[model samples]
Target: MEEPQGFFSTGDGCVGDTVTERCLVESKEPVSHVQLACGLCFCAFPLDGNELCVWSTKDPSYQPLILRGHRQPITAVTFGNTVSPLLICSASQDYVMLWSLDECRQKVLLASPLLSLLVDEKSKQLVAGCADGQLWVFSLVERHHYRCVTRVDLKKKRETFSRRVESRLCSLPEENRRPRAHGLEKGEDMEGSLPVLSLAPCDLSLLLSSECGCLPSESAPCLWVGSSAGLLILNLANFELEGVLRYKDFRSLSIQVAGSCAMMSKAGEQKAICLLTSMFGCQIAVLEIRLAALMRSRQDLGAGRSLSVLPRGCVLSTSPLHFRIAEEHRTPPAPQRRTVQDQPLVFHSKVRSSGYATAPHVTMFSPKTNTRNNGDSPSRRRSSHRWCVTNLHFSYSFYAGDGRWLACGLANHLSLVFRADLTGTPAVFSGHDGAVSTVCWSHDGRWLLSASLDGTPRVWSLRRAELVLCVGRDLFPKPIQSAQFYYLDAFILCSSGPELQLLKCHIDTSKDEIRRYKQKSRCRPVFRLPTAGPTEITSLSAVNDFYSYLVLTAGRDKTVEVFDLNAGRSAAVIAEAHSRPVHQICQNKGSSFTTQQYQVYNLFATTATGDGIKLWDLRTLRCERRFEGHPNHGYPCGIAFSPCGRYVASGAEDRHAYVYELGSSTFSHRLAGHTDTVAGVAFSPSAPQLATTTLDGKLQLFVAE
Candidate 1:
């Protein structure tokens, strides 16, 4: 008998290593606690057998390094964020132990039970929140000089700040007095203080300067401490409370988790930060605070001056404390249920429904020029040679303004234009030297625009299937991600890396070889709008519906920003729109070329990996609904709204297209046809037709019977 060529050899000892590695992860005891460090580099857990297992998250198949020293039940285990010599810290009833993975050495510190632990790499400090309403700061400046720097009694600070605030309020007139401030309960001063639950650092480097009118130094980081009563901002340098933020509406909230994220500012001199707090009672609050106000509060709390309240105007806006729950929608009874694959995708074109063969030549209005010399020559279609699908690439495709044509960008340095029904031969436009990434059509359906990774954008004359204008490579510093006809085709809009340019282009199809390189010089940038934080734009969307002025862009930093072209500035920003980078965004551009109501433009949808498609109202800047049921974790699947705006469609990793009613969270139809991950989806504006493309270079079309 012959051995299989791909089979592993047991004589090489591979089978024994595999068995040993598999058994190492198996334990008779269950894991009681688990904790993961900040970048998810390391994970630590305490087994029920009183043993601590520290494992590398990057490679979990290997045997975990185990440490056994704690005698009492481990209350908490944390991993430090240091790059080298992974630091593992654990707390017990007696003390806290720090284990260095590199040296295999252990250091012990006497302390009380800790609820939360944070290791600050910049300051070389270990900060812990104790169960006794206190904060312990340990300095690790040197191996031998490690010692407790200071301990803050949170309960004492809260009481003293409360009394100082009450005394100041007592001096006001009776009519001016309102409900007890800070959401404090009646006779709360007589009760005990709230226990500290969490601690996080607030880096002042996110802002330009500190409150004392000087740049933020390396040692001037702030600490945000969360407790049952409220949240307190403390100056880590002196361990003094700077400001307190309490929700007046939710007096019973016990804040357990606190976090912060920086916001992009229009002006480089000032920025803002959003402080987020989650309480035990299913309540969460998001407060946007300006850096100027925050630094001013720090100045007001100097050694000689004392103010316990947050500085006025520091908080730009505060969302009401509430929990977000996906609305469950009950599907209504229908006349008849239809399967998703009821209609089959027919391949109407014989030549892969893509490009033609010959290249068009340009001359200075010469009568000897042959009219059939364009790439759409009929003789080439009958030849033995044909365009290979192996080199073709499809990034995006869309329906024409009149719904009669479909344009698709290809990686083979060409774009294909065909009928919407996938019938008839596609008109091929070839000029780009790199893969074409984006395709846009003029509102009148006379001209088409395309962009490619070759760092140039070209305009094609649809009637002649010839390139009229092309931009130069030197104009853009990076490859163009997207380009389209904006403002009724009066100007061109393109996003190249982190910058968006609005250009006034003059179309010149004069193919005189002498002026061939002059087309790029005809276009000049009118506005250069860079995204906040200089984040690279992943997706761009703008409707040419009667020259709409709003341009929306999604950045790699998980932010959706709307630029007001009329105002020449960023109008609004939706920060942290999703947990990951937003890859697809679509506005409800109806099939009709006429401008519809403003509400139609206001409703847009955004999709990120793993996160479901979110419907947002531009006017309110809030998520109106979330449509899920499709798995899109590994790929940046495309999303689009139906022409009527009644339904939304998305491609998923499960090789199917999901269609959901706008008012419902559950999927209404699961269209199955593709064999690979569906990466792009588009709905026809003129008819009830849908098109989907897969990652493996396959296109499918579905039409309502």
Candidate 2:
């Protein structure tokens, strides 16, 4: 069978009978788990009517086998050995069913609510671990049906019935027999509490039991069981305990034998592999068992000793993320496109500790963005308390004139609104269909410019609380990366993906209409600067000297290119600006230095990681000096030079924000307050106050102390 390759496609089923609709597939329910065995792929999901559905790996068409014996949900399933008469076993709350894949019939092997199922060492028998703290052994030799021939009481087997003239605890050395106060006591009964969580087959269990008199001369394979107490290797032959791998605080939730994936040396000696999932955390430990160490060990097996097996590696589950540069949401020609009012998402603040300063707590409040009101901060008047009025990003945040209003673009396709005091407000702008990448403010602070991955650029008027204009995809085929309004909003200079475009807009404040137009008036690009750039520009900053201006764009390739709008060509390119990807570039928001009369621009560039900030002289087309001391993080640091151009502040991934003296380029004191990454930091335009935005959606304020 061929492995399914390429990226997984997602969409609704097609309608037409044409060739383009042939590959469209649909599912009524979501798949819970996927399994592959003997070159056949199986997807398992609980059916609507107390049934379990198993579907095969065929695209555009599906065939499922309905298994309906269990009254409860099916918790686990596994395939049988590679021998003749293939079998599949399922474990649920009611009983364990052993079914023949060829015959399509099954019989209850045991009347036990099982948690895990596995084939024994010889592959001729099955080992079922139940929630009743018992191990049931069943033989698959019968032609008609398998029967549970024996059962092992896990608690009794762990009691350590010694063959020699010595008590189990007294048999160990004086130092090794020390009592453990945390674990279970000798008389404590854990009968109903200790449920079998995970199970596997191991040969080492048999080898260890052979040395101790606990070995039984029976004919069954060995089974490894994992419980809340620790890991135990059981000799299924005579229902005796063999070996143990102990971990006190963590309980095992799932187990898998990586024996097939074991690494071997030139001498043909193979390493044993085991993967165990923790019940409390999303951590999976990969332990490499050495049979040599177990065979030649001195620890007494009579008094259950902890096997010194450390994890060779670990597998941590990562949060899944979905983002796009821009999604083309084309409006159908007339009478189709409609207005969409997005549902309000509960806004939260201060999810983590305040590291540096303690501000007044914004008791419990409902907000569209992460903004919460505290003390006497004003609140918006929204009739529906269940839904917030204004709503909710990263370095995507920008301050509008004197920092009266603040906007943050986020990955959730929403922008947050906050006042200069970092308090709650109801004036949030939301219409983007994709992740908001960058936001800019008009110099006068009246208009707000925002570009998103949805290939749409919108202009918002703060005074009017309305969406002024939207630059449609008809004028922008690619997503806009970064956008900045020229001096007074004459032409919006935008990083139109790999190139640049000067989109023109008219200030029509006279029309204060509360409506979404299906088809807005289309405007063409007045100026275009095309550079078949190697990568999409992630950061853009435009500096207009009151005439034919210049825009600097930082690409993923770690190169910065200066585009002269007058010449309509690339002026200067700065290579190796940083060791890693530069995500932010800030030109002095105030003006160039008066000392350098000929120079027009001085910019601060920050990379995703590596050394600190880099200052560039656009006149010389080279780096002046790098500002070190601040640590780099994954998210682009919210970097900004103070209005006076005396200091610079940038957010850090480590829940801290860094301050630097622009002249000395040395590290200053850090604003330490926040539990998560400080995503955006900006200095107040009017005062000496600093504002910070965190990933958890809180806007923090700090005074220069």
Candidate 3:
């Protein structure tokens, strides 16, 4: 038996076809808790309480990786450091389990009566934070038993130190040490005399203890603690209190230090990585504490600095604190440095405000031939101070001829026209009962046409600031989906229900009557335009000459159809126009021209779907190219061609407006800062300025570079 041929096709000849490509621009980084290794691909395992799922960087889909066996929700998971990679540590409530990745077998590493557990690099040590505000460090041995090696008992440790100091002072000779020394316990000597307490048996020499509220650094095992008075650093090696770093009023929640150095292969070398945190947004501090630096500081304390060093061939630096020494006796160490790692992974509980300064707006010039600097000497300048209109709620906006006036259609069924000079009150025209879906002004700037969800189309006289006439339901009795008016002929093409209708308006003062000349419907309402099943009409736009052509309509059926008014028939049908529903379509007047000999006129502009924006040429009914720099996988909500035909600006559901240079087919700049979806984008007819409206009830004006 022969296998059936696949239904999918490739290449350029057919309409309603599909094409796929990898995206080049990246959106916001995905939120994840644990990352997995897969060669060059970085995958994140996202946990939502009980489920364990993995998502890769190359693909958007996520799948379940592990399930069952975990009595409580897994807090964290990490792979082993070795190439053989047998162990995978899973931290859960009160315990951490070491599981063999190949066999899927598990063994309890450290069982602490705590809420959370964290395993160190070797999986030989585990750190657990308990409900009693204490941290427990546990060690595992080959005998299959866990031992508590160190316990940071924060409860009443200060009180116990006070009593011990009092007893020691009483035994001192009266001539050598005065009784007044008892008050010194409240200061410096309090930390130095505290004894190091061992919680369990371990061969390692280091044992550090301090107050409850602090975290350990990556390089040094020195735990930084914050008390009611100031910051304290405890040396983990000898359990001695180190020097204080900083003093502050509020107790520190977290602290990080940063620096930079060349890579080295040997231990006791200087290295640094910049550290940032939620506590301080952009301020970075240098963390300069080499093994040599620690050893020198120890010698300065008269602790006998000549400690036994590790063998030359030893790769792992066992004690991070012992490598530091004074610079005078140093041989500059070896050129080999520890491999620099990525930034430490930390979970911040508080939101941090951005620290980036606002950039001053600058201006440049764009001539017909080439772009050039506008002034005598090109220099950046701050934009003019203007009041931001915060009360306006507009879904879309457009400028009239020469940008003398800006017209915006709001969700409240009001069309407002503001003077470009920003001097007078904006003219308000309200006629529709529902939201105004679309609004546009005539080419001559005499009339404005608006379509609303109220199932009517209204024409407003700009000079009078009043509705002159209403179309749709009064004549066709169907809801007007979209409408556009021609300034020269006073002809209007409106999409009503499933049909495109043409209407001509006339006014007679003597008869005191408004006359409407209705032409035949260009496209018949066949199949109800497939309201469902991927065939609903999404957008409609008109070309330059209304007498020759009436409208262009795009639908979810992946087709663009041109309606011819003169011939009273569908002029051309461009099938398979987009991958998804085309939400917006606009005609480029400058590109829509043909010579007598060529017999080809192309309308160059943009159409949008859920994927991205595509530049289309109407003559061949083919997509010439695509603009692919939207940061999010957003549905394009609005698009417009610059008056000079040099740029195309598009708005998306991602709350950003992207401007693309038409000649070079590259992105010009991104206009962000919108708090909600950008519903519409428009360019000024006179100046190098653009306007956008968002769902957050705000209007923003941008000047081009």
Candidate 4:
């Protein structure tokens, strides 16, 4: 079998010659499995061979390192979950071997034929799932000793429960004549179990189709075990099975590989969690998991002390199996070279329109005012009118995921969507009775969500330029401070008063009032996350990546709270983040233009009134860098990371935007075009375009020269 070559897409929205194949690794014998470790190296094992080959992709000239220890063919291999990618575990029938690449040492553990392995670095635990329905848990003592914690027999546990339920039902008196359901087997004592095929640590970042944030913390950790029967979710807190999920249509599914990704739903622009499952490399299927409903049901089951399995209602909505055909290898296409800008960036002097531009060139001042003095000429009057549209400043602004559009929330109770270059006519979304505070674009860039002081969070269809869904203001306790699309737009996250609410909603644009009302009724709150402080939340930020589940929020009490959406709990807190309430928080959404390491995406920045911006690493929970010199006293002075993640751009009270290099503390560039305090800044995801909104209702557009 030939190994597939690795390729990276340029993401330039081109169909031909967009993907470029980098390198190809070859083996003398056919490789059985290959796994990449830390995005630096990979290990490949051949079938019917007792040795595995490890190659460092960083050095192309280096030869593959052969590691031999297993007496039998390796069944499974996994890299250790640690800060340093030095340890790896290989499983076989003889024993499970843990190898340290740095020291070239191995620790062997006598165990059964393990099919799957999971290493928990934080908890110092390792779980091995065998061909039989047995889960062996081990404790890693001081990174060397491996002591058996407990052995869980999933098959026996299910059998025991089924037998007890069957005996109780049989003891009851038989009913007279009853309508019977199809496939109802009489006296069926047990639900059959399947062998464990694969295992992955339960991570909200991994399960929710987001993988951009930090690793899973040690609190309430869980594991996802895939088998032919169903996917089993086991709570590592007590090493007990918490929930079992089976597809709605399929009775038996051989889930060899199971993962989640963001995909469009059949109903309009709503996003859904697509569960991709592979069966023994022969069959593939894509199923949809209603994450909000499933999570709600999980909580109800826990409250009722029924942890055997998830209800059928929580089962995924089944879809037809999809088969993928392998394409033959062909000659590589010529790569396209893009022209680089001559200068780094250039800012425009004239004020650019942001919101609700009805008349293209309307005269705001009267003819008498323009003729009064030479300073108040027609040019000056036109510039002044453009600078203060609707007499309302922008409250927030964000660039769309693809960098093609920009969304801005204004104080005049309106939301605006503009082209990145501010060339096309702005798409105005109205209806809010108060100032629009939060503006967020959907991952697909088809929808825009805005939250206002009126307490309503409205979803607007960008294509139709209409409101598709809106929540009542009476439903919330206080005004909404922040709102955005979370979990691939599967849930709407907003902060109201001191509570953070997660809502799962469906977008219905039906003309029928009754049908629209029914669809609106289907929108429900999955959970609420409250701040640790007594006061309300001041700011919040979360990455838009599909595999990120970490939501970072700031409190009025001068603290930063990190919530793990996967576990639905506060994972960590950074107290006294600033002397005053934190005003803004921004995460480094890695860019396609630059090749960043896996850990770079975990970095974030926070700023507060009168305080300088501080960069933090989510993994270490420590401040890595402090950027000062920019005067930010009253306004929030929103900050944003450049597309390449190498620079940070922030608004300032000095009537300018400051750009700082990540390695240095001093400001690198001072953008001095704004006439008032800069309110917010946004960087284009696809290009070197920077947009700044000022307190004087002026929008400035900058592009690479």
Top lDDT hit = 1
Per-prediction TM-score:
0.50, 0.44, 0.44, 0.45
For model 4, how does the per-residue alpha-carbon lDDT over 450-469 read when each residue is reduced to its tens digit? 88989999998877898888
lDDT of 4 at 160: 35
Cα error, candidate 1, residue 587 (Å): 1.4
Q: How many clashes would you count in candidate 1?
A: 0
Off by over 4 Å in 4: 1-402, 513-522, 592-594
Candidate 3 structure lDDT: 0.45
Stretch of 10 with least lDDT, candidate 2: 315-324
Backbone steric clashes in candidate 3, count: 15
**In candidate 3, residue 362 scores what lDDT?**
29
Model 3 over residues 1-705: C-alpha lDDT tens digits?
A: 011123212344343546453222221334345443342322223244443332224432211134335566666766565323334566668567665442331111122234445554333455554433345555553332454544454433443333434544554578644343332345544322221111111111121111111122212234433332222333332223333322221134234321111111122223222122223344433233333332222222222121111112322233211122234653323323122223322112231211111121222222122324344232222112232221121112223224467777777777777654333456778878977766776655666778887877777777767666676465545556666764233456666555665665542212223533432222212112222233446567764322223357776576677654433456556554555666667765421111111111234454655445666544334344455545323434677876445567777666778776543223445677777777677666545556776766655666544
| lDDT per model vs. reference | 0.60, 0.53, 0.45, 0.59
lDDT of 2: 0.53
lDDT per residue, candidate 2, 254-339, as tens digits? 43221111111121233455565655556666766565553232224222321111111221122010111124554212111112
- Show where candidate 3 strays beyond 4 Å: 1-51, 54-72, 75-401, 421-423, 472-478, 508-535, 545-547, 590-601, 632-636
lDDT for position 230 in model 1 = 53
Please name the candidate that would achieve the greatest TM-score relative to the true structure.
1
